[model samples]
Target: MPGDALVHRINRIQGQLEALKRIVTSGEADCVKTIELAKAASNAIKKFAQAYVETHLDQCIEEKVAVKELHGEMRKVVHSSFSL
Candidate 1:
């Protein structure tokens, strides 16, 4: 619910997968099409994750800066961040 654009993008990606499934089930899709669909899905997910992580840092880490006792919080976030 963060924004209509984010939700719309997600829905469009979902629709693409559903359409791909129909193509495969109908025996119209081949290996190349499947791979391309997968790549598109991966790119969509990567972009979404990047936006989500940025928003979380802006909201949580910025707020944590006001608390002087949690000096290691940022370090922990960096260490535990996605290796991708």
Candidate 2:
């Protein structure tokens, strides 16, 4: 069920990407429209990444830290998830 939800989110992102591609290829998008589309795509990507981190990585880190109080491992998880 969780995987299905994740897949649905990914599909929505893909649709946003396709919309962005259409805007670029249509050649009718003005500067404002282009910027708007780009921003929308960027926001979608950010939301997806944030959801992934919160849903998957956070749970994994919590599980690991609970099993063994590995502060360094938890820090590494946080760094890797948030880092570009």
How many clashes in each structure? 0, 0
**lDDT string, candidate 2, 3-81, tens digits:** 7877888898798788878878898778897788788878877787777777787676667755556677767777986
Residue 40 shift from truth in candidate 2, angstroms: 1.3
lDDT of each: 0.73, 0.78
Angstrom error at residue 33, model 2? 2.1
lDDT per residue (tens digit) for residues 1-81 in model 1: 566667776887798788778878898678888889878887887677676676565677667766664567766656666
Best by lDDT: 2
Q: Name the TM-score of candidate 1.
A: 0.60
Best by TM-score: 2
Candidate 2 CA-lDDT value: 0.78
Off by over 4 Å in 2: 62-84
Error of 1 at 76 (Å): 9.5
Residue-level lDDT for 37 in candidate 1: 88
Instruction: Find the 10 residues in a row with the least total lDDT in model 1.
Output: 61-70
Clashing pairs in 2: none
RMSD of each: 4.0, 3.6
